[model samples]
Target: MQQGGNPNDIFIKINALLEEAKPRFSEECCIYKVPNNIRKLNEDAYTPQVVSIGPFHHANQNLQKMEDQKRLYCRQFIERSETKNLESLVSCVQEMEEEVRSCYSDDIKLSKEEHVMLILVDSCFILEFLLRFYFLVTRGDDSILLPEQLLVHIRNDLLLVENQVPFFVLDKLYYLSFPSTLNGEDLHNHPPLLSLTCYILPGFMISEDNFVLLSVSSDVDFGRIAHFVDLTRKLLLKSSKLFQLSTSDCSREAQVTHIYSASELNELGVKFEVNKNTECLLDITLSGHTLRIPFIRVHDWTELVLRNLLAFEQCHCIHESYLTDYTLFLDFLINTDKDVDLLIKKGIIENWLGDSNAVAKMFNGLAANTVTPDFNVQYSNIFKDLNAFCAHPWNKKVATLKRDYCNTPWKTVASIAAIFLLILTIIQTIFSILQVVH
Candidate 1:
């Protein structure tokens, strides 16, 4: 107690500070900084390699080279959009500045003008890029398709959880850029922004078959989508029936204690099969002795995509946790490179990453810092069924026999021959005893 100030004045100042410190979390805030614990595992996965989309990495000096490209795209968007001018696009973003600001979890340090400008430039760049990709795919235009690697990087950067603008911003800009009538009627009648986005990001699709399903799926409600990452997730969920199935018997409080690895399960007579019918990667199912997993192609981008999706789930959608659950489910099944090998043999995993060990490590590392609800886990039923199947006495005995003597054909033959010789000796001894008695 320094004597000069009144205690009540000091307490009043402290209360003012506490009021300022109150949490500013908004219901609309969806984009988030990747949790430090998760980011520390592989920072590169959650970071933008080529370009920064929003305020998160906008100031990164490394990404400054793409700033010119973004401005050029913004210019092109204005020129080709045939809207009044740049003012029109600026006005659009300016109107939504507050809403846009609320979408970010962290306090954006940029001034209001700077923040609005950032969104405008980044949003236009994305729209222009997606439009270029759409023309390249639809109209055989190869102008922007050159240097394919850069395109891939930008596509990936757009999907990062931190590198995002609200999807509605893009939607508004798209409509403004290409009003009802502009040029060729055939190409002018382009698919909606969501559909175009799906088309541009084919790497995230479960399969080539699902490409059309995702592009044309009417079930995806565009209004609910928060950003590009969320759009991709929603499209995937639209095609999946994993949670729609009834799990009435499974307790909501059930927690997955343990599950046998792929190799161990195989030894216990559990078969692995690729489910060819579904386009949803998360639509894995276990039928009796067979486990059906969708074919997943694991290339360089796979880990990056998965890590960002996991981060997004951890940050914004902890309650939903569909991607998190699916990832952890895979993590449970894949304990070692041998598990990766088993899945590869079953055609369940297409390991374009070349090393099975890397794939196994990637899956194993993805669940780090993730929390799955002990109650109502999406894979709780699967976990229970798999444990029950492996626990059966018959399965355990079969596994033991397979491990001990019947693993190889030569060993199996040798065991059978030994059994036959034992039976013959026993019979011979009995006959000798009977003859002696007679």
Candidate 2:
């Protein structure tokens, strides 16, 4: 205004600035598209085959087959929940449409009406599936999702990072469908969402007894769960409290360049054993010249679950690299069939994949697609301690002798007796030579 004599010019400039409106969200901020590079490795793991939940592949030809079933579930949910106002659900989402859209990294091109319907249908289907699927698996009841194989595919689909409805939206719709009630029993008890989720993805879970004894509650609001992928990750983390990053200000990694494979470590006289501790699965010990690892079951679905976790770590959870670090550690430990064999013999790895080579290939391939951080990031102390232990000559000699002479109980006994007899014979010969010389 001070420089320009005409107000029209200034108004024009302002209008130009106002034309380009800023968006509410950015990609990689919350939920994100699976990077093409990672997806290319195992496209099936990233894609939804049986059903699609979110806007990504909700309209695909293969996924469209589930739409009728989804509608059926929705109708059943409507009956079970006895929801009074369906419009309320749409209005609730419409109020925060921009915010809700922001949760997804990609632009959803659907109209407001279509978007709202997607939410209503997807959320309703998820709720019903969780409830019905849990009952079927646990109780062996009515055949809601027949052929059981379909159920398996659908279960995998639910865990896909691409197929997700926002947790907040799900939460609102959930409570709307099932209004909270205050009874004599604790309100902070088991939430159906947690139970259903636990049932769907049992492979990724560590707890053998269906996370039923989990300490989480419905009353506690888990802050801003991005979607089901994030929820699964959170559950994994909740079960393993020791995985929380240490409050150390500085990043201290170890001097380890590379961790030897399990078999290689064994040759260096490192003993292999399974850790019976019920803490973090990555809670490994290298003391007493023994390397103890927690039991990790290896199955065909193992790679799928791990790949999803790897993708999740890559796209989200950037700060805490627990899953990334764990997969990388396993990759380093299992470079070949020999390594898998050693782990199997030690009871550390339960190979349900029929052969040791498959497990080895799985780990090797997992390491291929993953982002390996600095060697000493989280396990700096453990690796440093391991390096010191492995570098010791006494440990090497002991390990060599144990491997060569004491491989089995019989071998150890025979070796001990032979050594003892040899020593006695030497002594007698020395005494005889001394008498003869005298």
Candidate 3:
């Protein structure tokens, strides 16, 4: 007992504990596991299916099948990078281990060697894959992405929360592979890092028409990127000034509350039109009684992608949570299956899901545990305008009449005829009253 309680040993243990308590590295904090509370809503959305790029899901048995494949790609990448010394590459990557570790919110459970191996293997695979895949597409030979379905799954896996490697790691490997000494101009003239990603994935096109989707600034620092998900988000919300939180700066004022569904808005004679403008997916403009919304394709992958995006906003970027706000806006717009059907009919929502009810459930489900901030400038004007329009007694009566009677062509004709007769009767009564006065 006396030996175990020695004063010198106790002081040494105390010092070690204190040393571990402080934050260790100065790297920008990003790339996190979906918070457990948020992930619980839809665990499948956050989990990877085909590949695990980082340590979060490295131990998962399901993705172990791809580990050997990852090594194969790693070998190919080393050869392509023309790396003279594999040991130097390892050392370079290892040098940033503390910085890389600081990027993730979770304490990486992998040992130093294992973590470094993960970064090297994964970063090489992604860089090699993106470059080769882009080259294939530009050359009009998609045999690399052929057998289509597998490519689809891989594309889907890359955007999953658990299937991300930090952008820094990827950048290091990329520059090392294609060194800058002889290729300085290539760095400035190279297509966006997202070009291959966009080309591989649907909904994004690298056309001049959609510069917002493919326009990657050469001057923008790659180190600023958290992961693939962050890049995707940056593309989607191209204008941060609009959705970023502001109180005094917001010109559009609104209360944080739900509005009528798409069906209700339709009955109110508020037309829902597909947005022709390609500014942003969440850019919803309400001009007079018409709500112009960009069409969003809903497929098997849509739910997972949207949920993870929302989760990322919740965990890291709560103040600038445009995706969450957009989902909440949609939740209000789509309260029921009837609302979903209304949007589908109007081309505002391209629902590829098997059941319309599932789309309804998803939109409604997205708002779970969300507390909408009142002064969301991007949508506040739209919300306020809609509410003011809906609040008028005349609009409510017209909507009620349309839902109750003016549903069919025959009913609409009958309503017009009845109104005409009522007007004619009033005119006739006025003429009789004038005759009596004369």
The reply for model 2, stretches above 4 Å from the true place, is 1-28, 137-144, 181-192, 208-210, 217-220, 245-257, 372-378, 398-425
Residue 166's C-alpha lDDT in candidate 1?
94
lDDT for each residue of candidate 2 in 59-150, tens digit (9 for 90 to 100): 79987878887887876767766365767767887876766777787879999888888878888888887777666533343334776777
- Candidate 1: lDDT over CA atoms? 0.81
Shift in Å, residue 178, candidate 1: 2.0
Model 1, span 98-175: residue lDDT tens: 999999999999999999999999998888788777776432333335777987888889889999999989888877
Q: TM-score per candidate, in order? A: 0.90, 0.83, 0.84
Please identify model 3 stretches exceeding 4 Å from their true place.
1-27, 137-146, 180-182, 185-194, 200-219, 239-255, 371-375, 424-438
Worst 10 contiguous positions by lDDT, candidate 1: 243-252
- Which residue pairs show collisions in model 2? 254-376
Write the number of the candidate with greater lDDT, choosing between 2 and 3.
Answer: 3
- Rate residue 145 of model 2 by lDDT: 72
Better of 1 and 2 by lDDT: 1
Q: What is the lDDT of residue 183 in candidate 3?
A: 67
- Alpha carbon deviation, residue 392, candidate 1 (Å): 1.9
